[model samples]
Target chain A: MAEPTPSLAPARPPTGPRVWNNPRARAIIYQVLVLGGVIGAAAYLIDNTLTNLAERSIRSGFSFIWHEAGFAISEALIDYQPNHSYVRAFIAGLLNTLKVGLLGIVLVTILGIIIGIARLSTNWLVARLASVYVETFRNVPLLLQLYLWYSLLTEMLPGGRDALSLFTAFYLNKSGLMYPVPVYDGIHPFMIVAFLIGCVGAYAWGRYATRRHEATGVPTPRFWPSVGFVLGLPLVVWLIGGAPTAIDVPQMERFRFVGGWHVSIEFIALLLGLVVYTGAFVAETVRAGILSVSRGQTEAALSLGLRRGLVLRLVLLPQALRVIMPPLTSQYLNLMKNSSLAVAIGYPDLVAVANTTLNQTGQAIEAIAVIMAVYLTISLAISGFMNWYNKRVALVER
Target chain B: MINLAERRAASGPVIQMAGVNKWYGEFHVLKNINLEVRSGERVVVCGPSGSGKSTMIRCINRLEEHQKGRIVVDGIELIADLKQIDAVRREIGMVFQHFNLFPHMTVLENLTLAPMWVRNTPRKEAEDAAMAYLERVKIPEQAHKFPGQLSGGQQQRVAIARSLCMKPKIMLFDEPTSALDPEMIKEVLDVMIELAQGGMTMICVTHEMGFARTVADSMVFMDGGEIVEKAPPTEFFKNPKSERTKLFLSQILH
Candidate 1:
């Protein structure tokens, strides 16, 4: 009675070219009309701009990229002398744009994960704190948050020589926070190479260890190996004349602090605005994903004699991630694109740099074209990576 | 319904219930019920819908948690604490009418999952035990395929095999053939009949009178959440003791 005569024969998979000549030809027609409209509008705008410039006896071209950028950037990635060409200034501003974008993404992901888990906590206080964090940040506009953070930070920091001091020479001020910058010679580059090698080696070993644990139920040794490479290699490099080459503590003693790495108020404002606002939305998405998994699944995992942490890590999270990831990827993409709001704070991201370049050169077409291409490329790359990851974790059988 | 187990009789008692009562917000489902089943005994429970027959069976494993009752299966009593209920559930295998097999897992994995996870059985040993059970249920070849690929009859057989892999002292059938098509029902019954002949203790809730006649040593009739009558199958059918039981018998038997 108990014997199960299961079918070994796999059903033939469905096959076909399932699109394009289909009944949804209206979609194609609609897309064509939209494309036509965009092209028509762009041409009209371009014609109007050139006609106006000619009437005003102004030349329309990119000869301005070679002209000096007279304005001083409040904060810049590469050293930008006022004597540098506008094109060079644009490049520096573009790098700063990415710096804020990258830093914001990292902070939001880490904070989002922590807050998301906290929202699911059984402890009343932990869940409440997470709820408060999400609600407070999400209800406010991102631009307002940027203004608030920038203003509050500047107001708290000391002006001139009264900069707030930490441990030794690090100084916090209205202009920027000044942290130690390593002063070094040629050997410093080798130490950096060693540090990079150590990081890569440690990560590769960690991945290998994870695979071994999964395959054989034995955790591969990781701590000693990681420490030896990440810490020991750098130490050895330092002993070989890299120590003085790599080490330089920041020193501050006067009205204008000197000898340190500085972060501009604009950069801080932009990064803070993006992270707190985006992180709030991310928290809600994660909470929804966790709640979507049925309570019965948790009970079943417990009944299977799995430990509490193992139940969450293996049984609950695997299912929750399947539900969470598609939407989470979209949020991350939204955050990256939304960083263009850096212009509102006078932070010269691609948009701001391109705007100034267009004003000086009267080359509206070229400047806007560059802006569109850069944003489009960034958006497409994010989408492609997300799609790949989605396929990896998605449920195989419905 | 009532039965005394310790007469030191021919077959040993595998399950016993006494003074069982269940109420859900003022509606009593099972009322003052008592029963015991000897080893290898096959008891058929017949009742109209909403008769608490399911509730009574569910109480044996503390699934429904009877409001006031004492149910001891394979010697472990269902108590307020969960450990007692979990312990009782391990020894009492159950097959639902819906089959309730894990659809995501392969047939063999479904059979092995509980043993490997709950019983702490090694993977190899669990798979071996699962394979043996799959063979007993006549579905070893389908072990690698998901439950979705199997026909209704095959899934039921897999469900039966999954329970057997637990090696319970007794098996409970909660209308196992009710959800099957006419042709498929016969296959599941044939498997159950085979189990009954092999001396497995069983309590089946069913509308299949032919099966009841063939396998049930005794029969119990429940109505309106109460057991109204019970007797040995031959006597119970030919000369039932209650007017309500006679009416239930005629409606189902005819």
Candidate 2:
């Protein structure tokens, strides 16, 4: 109702950080001050770094990226030689970290879901067990949990030829696990291509099925389509001898895993610890999300004759996910940051590698920059995904 | 509020209760309650807070369990058998005072929920049924809007719409308009009146005596978990029987 107000009138304080008098001007000044502080600090540090570098008889630049990395990795997913450049070594480490991160995210999410649903179950034993798990894990220090998991594995795992062998294919030993690797020998660049195509088709088919079910009560045979893409595509390639590539399943041998790649105990310990500790936190968030859904919603669903299972899957989960996802994203970001604790286990994550490079090369400024850039990229990706999911499931009822 | 009924209808009762008792541990909430409601009847229950007016209707839906006596709704006995209770619940719809509309759904979705999910009606059929009910409530235009976006009255009406979507034979409203703004209260009352006129059996827990007088065939007054009086709207308003009912009527009317 209050219109025709003059813009030159005294600025409301909520207009955000302002100039001494002008709100916009005040915001500008505040921003510039922050920028100036950061730049000034960076400049001073850079000057100090350059002076130190000159005095220490060293240079700072990407020239080091090309120098041979003589250090050997205990486990490498790709072809690697000590003769490779430092950049190649860093790439190998980065890929390894991604591999661990991806697996950890998947396992923790599954574990979190199971525990959360268990917490709300009507069965007395199940509920009590879930509650106990949540209370125990949530209260313990995560770093301590990591150390416990490390020791538990080291002490329990079999040693040498006495190692636990599952399916006669995978070996669990004191050092770590050795499993058959699927190694492709030739131009089956088409495996990656077919796999990507199969994934896209599976996603599309699922969406189409959902749409079809919503439009018509006719249920589509969606499971077969997904199974076909996931299982059949790989089979087709294998049957055709992969047209260009052939795979081999490695076996254990004396003093070595002769046929497949070996996963170091350090990597397993880091991933296992990270997943369990973070999964417990994620479980709490999931439980809270489920709790936030009012009892009235469930009652209403029940009144409508919706069965328990459908009510949970169709009605409750969509709404609960909206509440769960925001906190869940924070847990994921925390897990990624906490993964930096890999230094404790001698795993070379981005931060760990950067920390070592800083100490060895005396290029502290560059090392810190690399750490910041890598983390910032990771944080941004997680944040973007969370925002997208938030938009997708936000309560339309509101 | 509108009062036209002068006497309780003379008929066999559709709902019968005897020696009904309920307690929340040591608190004897509903005690020795006895009542009857007939088919095609509209009854208004009124009392002070903690009088258990809401609990009585909830017991009909098995939303709250009574520890003693028995309640028979449309010939189905309310008992320990959960399946029977659910079957009876599907036949009766209850609207809440808080307008507990699902905040994650649109008004249309709210109205269609019970029909499609419970009744196993197809989406299109449920949507059509919902539209009919929404039209009855005079908020069909707002079908796509989320419940939170609506005013209290609108939300209550949508809740009523949601209950009606099940095509329930009986309706129980727990203070349907209590939370609405005064101006919006009439819109909901009007819809209730239309439903009554159409012979959809209703038991409303409300303080709107004016509404009770107009739409209700009889008014049941409760106090300390017992029915104090049951009379037609005209006699109930003009000359309430019991001393407690008179006192309550005085305070509420004033």
Candidate 3:
């Protein structure tokens, strides 16, 4: 038999019409036209707005950001006075927003996972309760829930003078929650350092235990020992420092409580509303993610003599996480944005502070732009992190 | 290898099921199944679809609960006790039609997971055992690859190796080759033949009559959730006494 020669010659390109009539050329032209239209529209809007501002004799610039903000904020994490600049007010509002957002994300995740697992519980009552929670919270609007919480906190609680007391150290009233705080002492910083060291020690111990278990067949006790290292070390340090027993507890004064740390009812209401509402959606996401894993995976693991808990931790969760991450990221972003509704309840989040600044300075455009930029940055950061995590958990396949 | 007859005589029945009955909701799936499988014995269960063959073996490991019956595996009674179920499961390995290999893990990891976690074997020991099994199955080079990266035949062989890593006394196969292509079926059957020749007690539910003839010491024909006939493969093939058995054999064989 004769060997067939391989064809190595390159095929000739299609001899078609001129560049103007070519398909690729038309595609490029169409894309350029669309791009130009979008840019032209944006430039027109900006020019029109600037011309209108000048004609109305309205000063439009970001210089107003440095001017004095002669307004009282309801709450502030950092020091802020009416004499402070608008920049300081904006920072306070941003901090408030971040405080609620970060805490809400953590609490909602924990609650969502618990409720999600509970929804699948064989016990009828627990499953029913979880479903009810998801349905009720997710069905109602978030703003309404915030309003309801705010009203309940402000109207139902007793007056500051007759605040409800818990163990004579914490006070709850319409004014806010007042809790005891430790008095500053030189030993306190040392105690914190000791606590940090204990944390590092616990982490190192956990790693070592895992390595030892893998190297040797014998397993070591991990949970309790790590706990002892973290908490026991702090306790030892406290004892060694002759633990200062001086704590400033709240006391009823002429009008309100004095001393101790105070938490505003607005902040509490905002956090409660955000967490409860977002937690319901997160629960559904969790349930769906878990259900996405096939029953065969569970049966295979069980057949291998692994316990149900081990099957869930090792096999089910790793697969379920891939399905859960994308939706969970959007849920987090939604929670952050929905936090803007805090303005309705007077929590003074970014939107609320920006609203005040715009009303005072007549720089609605700049204020709104700043608000948009901040939200855009937060949303992108969250999505970027979730994407990275999703990739890590994704399955490898041909 | 030890003589099969001597090995069988040395040990009593490893799996015993008497008056086993099961139901799925309102439907009766298995009704009064009574069987005994001695050590080093290979029982091939062949039947029409929905004949309760899969359900019967699933009951041996307590994967499917029997509503009313006594199933004692290795002297451990199958009951609501979790410890007992886990104990019996450790001695029994099961392979499914879909291969059910954990896609998230490599072939080596899948084989090593149960031994390292349940048996508390060290990582090095588990990997060594896994590599040996992979070599026995003739796919040692694919150890680091994921299950999804392998062919159907290779995946099935890996699944078999995974079961063997646990060093179980008995292995259950439910349609192990039914899901594979015609070309891939022989590779899986060859592995099973090798395993059978090694004196492993196996209960395989399959439609591959040639494999049954080659390896199965006993043949069981089930119809309508009951074993219609049980006999030696030579006797069962040459002269099926029951009408249902004759009909099933003719349908499958021709």
Candidate 4:
């Protein structure tokens, strides 16, 4: 060891010789430099893009979105004239996307949960069938599946006079699936009010039944009463108010059927493809989540004398959902993003309509930005909702 | 119902197993095991690993199906009948090795679950019973806490309290103290000993010979899917009848 320094001199601080040499200071400096580099790179790209747009004499902004879009969408949920603004077309397209995405989420979750449980069934045939379904749908590319469904609906189904008619109100043909629309004359609002009241009454009834069940051992059946609440009240009110609702059956008049609600083949193809494809991955996620809980949980619950159904409802599902929710949120987000593939099947989703706007207006950057912004908003919304749900079901692992 | 109550109150054996055999696929896990546990008797079963000690007790609650056996609990015979299985399970409470408390529920909720759902006890009544049991197990302060928040010993005690809330006639403990830390084992064993002193019929599968000696009315030594020797704890420890029991006792005690 070196000789000790003179005691009179100021004692050297324990840390380091300089601020630059200090670990905490160095870490801050390194992060600042990385942040600067990232900002500089982003600034450069933005500048380059601006300069290129100027050189090409292309106006880049959302101003042109208000211009008229002359192109017509084959299928629209809202009324759209060809003379309507591109903004209107974009709104319709966005609604289409939301419609399909929401429906797909619901259908896929049901299908996935059913298949997931069936795969774990003791019945060999049911398990095998679910396995076969999962393998078949998951292995095929979604785009290819969409194409196949599109062709099948367009080509396989007979056209015109040979249209397959279900009862007198529904028709299936090359055009699309058509179903009867109820045309309400007067007193529609009263019927709607009655329906709403029935729903609230039914909810109160359920709460009362649950309370009664807890107080006594007698369980009140909820299904038939719920059905009556939904359908019976509305029907009763309609009859009392001079039943003004009439079914508008579609009439086959030569080329196409008239006066009915129609779902286009493109919409059908996109929906089927998205739901069936995403459902397989969801099924696997569900299975893994349920399996992650140890078998002892069920044994303990059953041994405590709970019924089989009660054991599953109280013990298995709560634990399983804790493991299921986080990954299930990601699967939902993926499904929403995958809906951008609608362009391949001629479905007028946001991307498809935005592409048309870009081609017509020559405002490529703005169009692309709009599409990105909408997708980002939708993704954030879905994740936000799911995060709340996940927190509610999360284990209290204090 | 009157006859059934009369039979149950006659003070015969609460649990009986005769010529019980079980197999997992092709491997025989339990072989021709015969055992009996009377009312309010504490039977401690000790065995080496894979000796079918847990399996034999599990058969009493029908957690594991015995392929060939005449197992009966509380005057009702165990069979493939779902109704009878549920009835027997309702009367017999079990505690697992890992303290398999429902992690999602609070300690009080876990205790009240079976009482409310199975026994149809009202909420206030179930909660009252649960709090009483929690006090008995000496963890009433942690009644609202989740299982994960408690130590291993505390969770095991909560599990025992949960079982007692059901008012079970017979309790089966499958290695209750096996999963606890060394210091924590004493607390759990203390609770179990208190439970024993209160005249609750209990069949415990464990290696805690000291505990067995303290509370067990009879000690059973099992080896390789069969009971080798069984006697009062003092006699069993002093003079084990079988060579395997002697070897096991030497290895464990030394």
Candidate 5:
């Protein structure tokens, strides 16, 4: 068989210039054009703002940051006076913000997890109650909730003289909560040290028990013994220190209570608002995350003879966390930013303090820039940590 | 390889189901099913789709709660109490059609998890036994790789090894080879056949009739939420007693 005679095709047409036809070259040109446009626009805006400031004789710089802040802040986490510089005032505001933000994060997480699991409870009443809480809190606007709490605390509570008393040491009224604080004593430091040692000892015992269980195939009781090491050791130290009992309790002095530690109503209202609002969203996130795991995984774990708690810890949580981390990070960031609404209720958070500074110094651009930068930095840090955690818990799929 | 007399003399029935009935919402999934599995006997359950065969076996380990009747395994009854269910599950190992291996863990970790946590076995001992099971399944080298990295056949075998690592007294296979490719079915079935030869009591739900004829002491045909016919493999295939079983056999065997 003679292989059919070879056939030739017609010659190809010439192509256009490579620069315009090439995808990579075109992409580079488009990126350069966009960058140039952005830089030009930014330069123009900067020059225009500076010229306008000069024309109006407005002093524009960060020099105002060094000058003394003359206004009084309602709440300060750190030592602050009207004579303090703007830098110190801002530091106090930042500290206050951090206090509420950290506390709110912890409280909301615990509340959210409880509500999320409760929503999945077998009891109809528990699930219905959880659903009601989530719906009621998340549907109302956060600012409105803050206002509601502020009004409730200020208008409904009795005067400080008629404050509601708990054991005669803790008092609650329009002035917020007043409680007893332990007086500084030499033995206090020893007790704290003993507690720290007790914590470390309990942790060590847990580790040793796990090691023993692995080595011998015999499990040991962990809960009660660890509790003993943690609480018993501290009690022993307290007894050795002669058990000093000096406390500074708040007492009514004319119109207001004096002594002890007092939390302002503004701070309480803001914290309650942030926690209650963010908790509802966090609960939904948790519920969705747990539901994302297939039912087959749970059945498989149960078939392996693992009890309910062990199955949740060993199989369910590890899988659910991968789905939970990203959205949970968003909720944390939201809570932190939502705390800025503290200004509406007159709480001294970062944005509230910066607003005061801007009004006093007439440096709108600088004050706003500082506020934006602070929020951006904290938000990035939270997301970075969550990303690392998510990576650790993620599945190894091909 | 027939050691029927020796196995029959080993012990009484290890699994007993009397008047077992189950429902899903208003749908009756299992209806008054009664069965007994003796020690060291291999029984294969075959059925058409939606026949409740899987649900029947699932109730053996209390994965699916039976609305009525009693299922006693290894002397403990399956009940609403978690303790009894856990006790029953410890003695029974089940293989799923989808091979539900923990995807986050490697093959070795998957095999060792139940033994170490549930049985309270030491980590080293559990790992040693896991490796041995992996060797038996002929995938010792794949122990370090995750389930997602393995082929369907290899993953199924790893799952079998995971079950065997616990040294369960009774093994339940629920459509073990149904999800596998035609070329890979024989690999899993070969391991199961070897397990049968070692005189393990097994209840497998599979459509692989050749495997049933080779290893099963009895063949059970279920249809419409009930066991329509059950007999020895030779008699069940050669002479089916019920019309449903005959129709199912004719359709499936072809």
Candidate 6:
């Protein structure tokens, strides 16, 4: 390792290794090769698919979406006919999927929180019951649960002729469940306006009460006032606006129910399955979240003379929600995706409609792509909202 | 509740325990303990870990139930009755070794919580009281900061402030300075000394013999689940009676 002359220093000898043998250069070269390989594979696959489609004379584009879908759906939230375009059918299917997903999320969240708290109850029997529920539903296969619920709803219930009537306004049969639909004919706008005004007033009063309590020691009636504003104001406005009072009760005709708010049996089965299955995972997540909080927190709250309920509401829940939310968001996404299982029970959700389109048109690639796109869009939207919520609740640690 | 002057004139003990025994699944933790702390008296309880000093003070507020005992705080006996337990707990303030201040709350919020919720004090009043206590601990500027952002000494002072906001008749400190750094211990100890000078009834479990010398009216020494000796700090340090007390003092003082 002798030093080179000044004149030759610019062209120094290789002290360590050649450029190709250098670790950094080798790593870059390897990464480039991997990237090229992936690109080449994708390009080849795309080319092969195009050539095969051309050979079979099967047009490959989304233009088929505009074609009429000549198939009747059992349950349609919006107006639909066999002559309706595939796009319309897709929209209807997407709406149904969203309906189940939204409702399941709400129901599962409530059930999960209750069961989670019950699992930690001081009462032995309550705790044991919650444990049994979580274990039972969580262990069973979700698809099997859907099948069982569907059978229970359709096979066990009587036909529409002998519908099980409840309070003479609601009826349940093998076809579906139905209940009275409220008709506000001409006074709808006034009632809605009154309800909105009441909501704003109630919110203002709540803020004022909180501020007054902070300034003085007097506690205001918060809960009852909120209830009154939300319910009473709307009722009063309906009466003042000449309450329509033309409720349409479910009427059982020869073979089916007519003129009422009806929920299809397929929708009910899917909802029950999604709620029961996803709820178990959510319960476990809730339990884990609560348990992650140290015992010292509870003892500290209790020692401060906070009652058990207040301790739970203030100290326990705020902390546990931070832990519960991130995982709970994933569970919600899982529920939304699992709603696709409705296809197995003849429910006209997004996936079920897509499958029908694929079978009729022999457009496997197009149909699969649409299905993936819909699911992907939904999942991303859910994740975006969840991430925002997660950021708000995360602990501000130094 | 009697006025402070009348209650002081009565000379009744703020805390009393007789034949107090506790067990953790047949493992006897506290045995045949008898103690009394009068109003405005500062008692220091010191022993090695597991000697039941912390457990005994915890029993004062019913944080730990004594299986066999009549533990009374401010005339409210410790029992399974929720009302009695709540009453006793309301009148007592507690500090922990880890400075178990709520991490989610600011120093001011931690101090004001019990005053507002338990005492039904107005939020404005609770905040003012919290600020006063924070100033007394000499860290009023840290009120808006969360516990996690504060140093160990500062957090401990905030815990002290939180306890004081309850306007408690008695304060219990479970190794308040044990978890602090060597340099930070004096800061917390200084706050404790100020509290003692203010005539707060305090039962502290600490190994800081210097703090004991400065603020303790009486020192209670325990070993093997029994109080080996109890006497005024002057007499206990100079004229320890039991061999266990002598041994404990020798080891800890060194």
List runs of model 5 lying over 4 Å from the truth. Answer: A1-15, A193-206, A220-236
Q: What is the DockQ ranking, best to worst?
A: 3, 5, 4, 6, 2, 1
Tell me what TM-score chain B of candidate 3 gets against the true chain B. Answer: 0.98
- TM-score for every candidate vs. truth? 0.69, 0.83, 0.94, 0.91, 0.95, 0.90
**Which residue segments of model 3 deviate by more than 4 Å?**
A1-21
What is the per-residue lDDT of model 5 for residues A145-245, given as tens digits with 9 covering 90 to 100?
A: 99999999899999869999999999999978998998887788888888889889989998999899888877766788889888888788878878878
Query: Which pairs of residues collide in candidate 3?
Result: none
Error of 5 at B225 (Å): 2.0
* Candidate 4 CAPRI grade: medium
lDDT of 4 by residue, A281-325 (tens): 899888888898899999999899998988988899999998888
Better of 3 and 5 by DockQ: 3
Structure candidate 6, residue pairs in collision: none
Error of 6 at A2 (Å): 27
List-wise, what DockQ does each model earn?
Answer: 0.10, 0.37, 0.69, 0.63, 0.68, 0.58
State which candidate, 1 or 5, has the greater lDDT. 5
Top of the candidates by lDDT? 3
Task: For residues A175-283, write the lDDT of model 6, one tens digit per residue.
Answer: 8889898764778787788889889989988998878867776656688888888778889988887777888888777877788898988999999999998988998
Model 3: per-residue Cα lDDT over A190-231, one tens digit each? 787888898899999989987887888666667898898888
Considering TM-score, which of the candidate structures 1 and 6 is the better prediction for this target? 6
Candidate 6: residue A202 lDDT (0-100):
90
Output the worst ten-in-a-row residue range by lDDT, candidate 6 chain B: B1-10
- Model 4 segments more than 4 A misplaced: A1-20, A185-195, A198-232, A242-245, B1-10
iRMS, model 2 (angstroms): 2.6
- Residues A1-398 of candidate 2 have per-residue lDDT tens digits of 87896679776678564348887878889999999999999999989978988998787776777777776665667777878876777677677777777788888899998998898899999999988988887788878877887888889887877778888888888888878766765435666666778888899999997667556645456878998996677667656763543345456668666676678888899998888888888988998999988887776676665667767966788889989988998888888778878777777776666665666676677777777787788878988988898889876655
The native-contact fraction of candidate 4 is 0.66
Quote the TM-score that chain A achieves in each candidate. Answer: 0.80, 0.82, 0.90, 0.89, 0.92, 0.90
Which of 2 and 6 is ahead in lDDT? 6
TM-score of 3: 0.94
**Which TM-score value belongs to model 1?**
0.69
Which stretches in model 1 have alpha-carbon errors above 4 Å?
Answer: A1-67, A120-136, A155-252, A256-265, A299-304, B1-254
